[model samples]
Target chain A: METSTRVPNPFAKRVIVVDWGTTSLRCMLVEPDGEIARETESSRGIRFIADRAFEPELMNALSSWFDEFGNLPVIALGMITSRNGWIEVPYVRCPATASDLADGIIQRRLPNGADLYFLPGITDTTRQPFPDVMRGEETQILGFGLDKEATIVLPGTHSKWAKVGQNRILGFQTFVTGEIFALMSEHSFIAKAAAKSEGIDWESYDRGVRVAENATAGDAAFLTQLFSVRTGMLANELKSEEMQDYVSGLLIGLEFRQARDCGWMKAGDSVGIVGNDGLNDRYRRAAAIFDLVTVDGGEHAAIAGALEIFASVKARSDAA
Target chain B: METSTRVPNPFAKRVIVVDWGTTSLRCMLVEPDGEIARETESSRGIRFIADRAFEPELMNALSSWFDEFGNLPVIALGMITSRNGWIEVPYVRCPATASDLADGIIQRRLPNGADLYFLPGITDTTRQPFPDVMRGEETQILGFGLDKEATIVLPGTHSKWAKVGQNRILGFQTFVTGEIFALMSEHSFIAKAAAKSEGIDWESYDRGVRVAENATAGDAAFLTQLFSVRTGMLANELKSEEMQDYVSGLLIGLEFRQARDCGWMKAGDSVGIVGNDGLNDRYRRAAAIFDLVTVDGGEHAAIAGALEIFASVKARSDAA
Candidate 1:
């Protein structure tokens, strides 16, 4: 198995990588050695482009980036290929390696006759025997060099808690705790029952977590406990921010307990957080309650993962 | 004390009863003896008709019926008088008798010059430090003659479990369990993951009740249990109907357990169910798990309640 130290660049040799997300689209011009030359981003993510047919607009936006690279091979890894995006690629089962996504698909045609590829999302199957879906986060997990084995926590509206091993997603679970909290705080009757506040109250958050942790079979029956938030406000007992934090803690704490019970994560498992800074911090603090170690997953992981796929595609084209 | 028994004209002294709900509006023309003459219903409920705008449409709908009764005084109950309905009548604390609502608002003019009275909903302050809300069911409890000290269970989207004594609604609690179960089983992510079928599977429903009843802190993760619905479906060990029933049992069972913990009901206390037949049957089955006796809530509770209110108004007017 002699490997070539000098990788051959198949035609134009340059590679274009795109990280198309829910809110924005980012394209990177990469050199053969995995170094960034020029990076440009567009606001045309799946959300913006979802209402219209995606393929034409995507090809048009992507063409300019390729033209700058002199018609180089382009590879995309993100939500761009989701059901609601430019194309829909079926999710590949976990225990997958970087090589598995090396041969994905690009649904659009280019004028310069450039080769294109898209990475498939990851899925997991384990004890519960259900599947978990991930688009852009797959790139970050790959970038974390978690190609071997690790637990990754992707926090968002619908948080994804996953187990990764041997470059494969072993299993995962999704929790709507964030969305539930948001809806309840903003739209549900609980909002009226909760005391109005303006700042984060750590004490309320702690109290909420304790309540969630000790919630018995009938605890949910007392959802009217939400009314206490308002009563507390009227009585000048709980600050507004504390009420908000308490609500957040209740939702997050419930999610955390559920995740643990589902065996989504075990004690002593190394957990990596991939999300925005503020959310990551909150999650980190919450994770401390369970004594779990947290790792930073900056935007670099996404770029690296995209570049890895781009390089693989270029290498394959050259070999063919 | 001297009592005079007088029979009002069946046609000229007809009573108008209105049962306005979230999604529909219903009106009935009743003879002096409470016999139904003509009934009319419409899609104009609080969900569609704004609180301030309901009066006009209601008057228009009942114009012909009122003509048949030669301008009989209409008594409106149910949601029409709720905070979100035609008139925002204040809640009268429970342990309330039929006479309480009967003494509520009287003689208001609809836009069409029709005279009407709105029944006040019941509020249970005895549970205070915590209070609960009841709209149309207050009339039904009065109709069922449960006002003289008994427990009443109203099963629907927001199931109302109440304790009444001496014509007063003593204490009560509302469980959003039905609404939660519907949302999770039909619109939420769980619906997508689990199978959907018709009818209840006793085994799966029983299993759900057991889990909800006895799940330990370490074993009570909803996410994990939710996923099992899918796995059970895939494994051909559970039916779609079973999944729905299981979710229902879990939620309702949890509510029942919580209500018990909150001291809303005692172990030996009699329970009366008010609702349609199906809902009452479900409550009966669930209550049987706890060895509690269930009684019928009678079909005429809503109408009877309205009649009781009307009778009170008549007595007050005569006294004046």
Candidate 2:
């Protein structure tokens, strides 16, 4: 859905949405209305690109596209806009709109006669301890659509629990759930026993979710509940093959419980689950345990979001 | 302190208590009354003991002590009694006494003509999701003295919050607080940005504890709070050097909060902090944040516990 009744595709031109992050880069030829055509990806992420030679590396990666399509305007998102990336773009503070992000969009002309635009991330100043922030996720949340009021969960290494309403992103909080799960799965005592698991064991996974729900509802054993992944095995309740999914379920479940505690949702509230991190299914199941209705924000929200914001930027420039 | 009014040193012999865990081995030549005459530690924990060659490894690690003492009795605690170790001794259920541990001891004749005793770990069956278990800690708790009823917090890689009363360990729960902290410190994004810091920044650490205390006192954001180490840095509230201690305080603080949530502690209550993991100072600081009194369990709690349990075993067999 188009966020607000903004002028549609004000530039009426095709865009090459570049989702460049720390570890990988993906470029997509997206239509004005968010239809993605031929795409290419590489391991040449910002981290791998040395000496800040991002321009040449990007040019080389898109050399074929530039040759065929004649310098299509490029829109870069994700960590490419971070302090460590090609250019450090300032974050637009929430509650933010597509136009707000468009206003913050950094524009530069490419040597190949293409216009380059970098979208700024967003931050929540009201978050205690410090302002909570996200780079690519704000755009991803924007892609998730802001036509209706609801809680949107974009699950990833650093999962964001965001509030979207009134055509703006109200605020959001970050949960290091995935990173914790990955760390435990690879480097912890849980990792030692969970070795050689083939795939997700739904039964064990659901059991984990149940444990988290029970703990959340009754006792506050979030830390103790984490130890359950091991305790369950010692009790002959969880098998080695099931440990991974069990830990996965438990971590995601805790994320949901924590999110609820932070006032993002209640049992009866509907929440939109969006992200390309492949954790949506698990998150959907987790939402079920919390009595939350899941609204599917289709894949390609990043592409949709980038396109929409780019069109707004073009409209503003033309008006100027 | 002696756990109860038990007969002292029934065998009238000095002892060697071996705290062999997953990654290291600590052997102490302890006098009958728990005085450490000499000690040695090695990287040769259970994981490094190849081909089940634990006997040879121990002999080599303690060759000098054996040469000097001829044949002191050896008592094994920690992971050495688990399934992966030399012998799979079962865990004694909670509400266990020193005598129960003594009765569960598995004795073997070493090559040096010394009696080797293995103390069984303890498990709380009432812990939801599954039984919570702790190796070596039960003995340490015993060493902490069970005569007075009190809640003991043993901080470690897998910290144990145990209840002691009537000369028996009533029940306990395990929190992987230390493990999570280590994992985040060395592997997570927090580790990435937190480079080159020496010593604990007490002020930063206190701020982290405050964050956890506030989260516990008001809302639930354990996962979100973990991200504060990063957010605090991004906001310039927490300097890079302070990140480590801040995370340390936050993790231990969450452990306390979770323990209280699990009904193990409360404000105005005096809790004893016991363990060999060198985390008591931080735990004490965290306890203060929750309005709880901290009682130092001293450094040699493990040695005392092991000696006391060993003494009980000797008394039992002699009586039999």
Candidate 3:
């Protein structure tokens, strides 16, 4: 009876933050102090949730957490809020803050007596030819903080370079760097010659970064520079095992170069690198080479962003 | 016996030229006037010729030509001369002419007692980090003729930008534009969203070209500009149907931009578009947008190059 009884604390303020993406589902139960109390995850992402079975899938994934923590409010982000997900939430256009993001949050109720909030992604309408958009990264950027007028980079499958100032995300751009790197490394002519290895070759990587940083005319051409990977191997400059890291450095370096060209950051400026996609180190390394001082961004920025937006939305609802 | 009779003429001077590649084999019975007398092609490329069966496969592919032409010398090029091919021929270093290419030829006698010359690929040793090598493109560059001092672009999976002057290929750079386009359009996030269509949308393509042609400091960065393809769709500026051609234009245009950055061609300069990959039209269009005049490079440049290199080698052999 004692074990079965709900042991409640005066500081108990529990909530569920669900970061559901196209390929995976992850739910984190946050305690009063924003520490993750319990976590559950699965491959049953929005795409994998069969025939609009989002409710059943969600209930199943969070059943253990719910059984432990009671009916906690859930704040959802990522592809789960996209057109393909449970409900299509419209993007909140930038220059936006946590409150603005909260205002854009879409709400629904689950059968288990819990409120579900789907966070809206962000869009930069000023981008040329079309508006640039970010799904989960905008939340991470928000979590990274908006008080500082600095450039923030959230590197992932589609890397983002954003300008944050005045407690708002001013504008942003996406670079398909990770996607390109994955494609080239996994299924390309470049992939064929690479010797698989788990360790990073910093020397080869540094050489690749320098190639990208070359001020000589024609040396900065990215497409042409890619050929140097193969040529480097053939010329015995880069060994087979060094190919992947070298390519990684080259790509990340180019991202910095392009970001610089786009006025994201200058030579001496500091950049905030958000997100934990295992690419932050490479970005940091590249930033250092490009004369940038990289600032530490919180790893839990996504959760913080979700919590802030949800609280603001709940406040507005209570006020109304 | 009458059907087996060889039709001989006084002007029947001919040679067998084989463009043996990774996935296919193409043999041409070339007349003395540089015309193709008869041709045969098959899937029996170097890769398919198992267990060092290169001779048997070569004989089978050109048996009819061999029987009719009676011991004509064969000139082979492309991947057939690569390390994985039948015989690994070393690359001829730039700035090379037909004679230099001829000197690099690796000769072997076929079992049928006919001469076989494997034309070496060209390597630009002066290229940064490593030497840049091209197998068949060098021959095509040769075939495009060394009579004029002009920049020539050979478009394919690995497109080339070469400068020719004083009857030689001065130096060159390789842009993996075609390969990148193929990978992105076939196996990327861009591929999933694209609505497949039989016809190309030229207007969308031109818009993409203009995006790459952006004089704005940020517009010219290829990695950032690539994101526009996705953004263009999200903002309804570009439809899913137009994604392919638009991406194509953006990539090809970037190649030209990068080539220009490398000093391949200046504004208002005439450059030759060589090779017939069905992509020449797009390249020509891109060239026009960049203010470069497109000249017709010989369609039979590969064959012409092989023949000239063989002739030069044979002449040098005689003199020696």
The candidate that achieves the highest TM-score relative to the unseen native structure: 2
lDDT of 2 by residue, A1-320 (tens): 22332223445667787899888999988665556767998889898998999999988888888898788889899999988899989989999999999989898888898989998999999887688989988877777787688899999999999999899999989998989988988999855788556667888788788788777432547878888878878888888888899889888888887787778888999898888778988999999999998888778778778766866766778899
Write candidate 1's Cα lDDT for A136-195 as tens digits.
777766665545566777777667777777665566666666655655676554344566
Task: For all candidates, state DockQ relative to the true structure.
Answer: 0.16, 0.66, 0.64
Better model by lDDT: candidate 2 vs candidate 3: 2
**Least well predicted 10-residue stretch by lDDT in candidate 1 chain A:** A1-10
True contacts kept of each: 0.18, 0.76, 0.84
| CA shift of A71, model 2, Å | 2.2
Instruction: Give one digit per residue, the lDDT tens place, for model 2 in B218-312.
Output: 24478888888878777778877788888888888888877877788889999998875778778888888899988778777887777777667
- Model 1 over residues B221-258: C-alpha lDDT tens digits? 45444445544554456666577877777667666666
The DockQ for candidate 2, computed on C-alphas, is 0.66
Interface RMSD, one decimal, each candidate: 5.7, 2.0, 1.5
Once model 1 is optimally superposed onto the true structure by TM-score, how far is the C-alpha of residue B211 displaced, in angstroms?
A: 12
lDDT of 2 at B240: 76
TM-score of chain A of 3: 0.93
**Candidate 3, residue A256: how far the Cα is off, in Å:** 1.4
Q: Which residue segments of model 3 deviate by more than 4 Å? A: A1-12, A314-320, B1-12, B314-320
Best candidate per DockQ, number? 2
TM-score of model 2 vs. true structure: 0.94
Interface RMSD of 3: 1.5
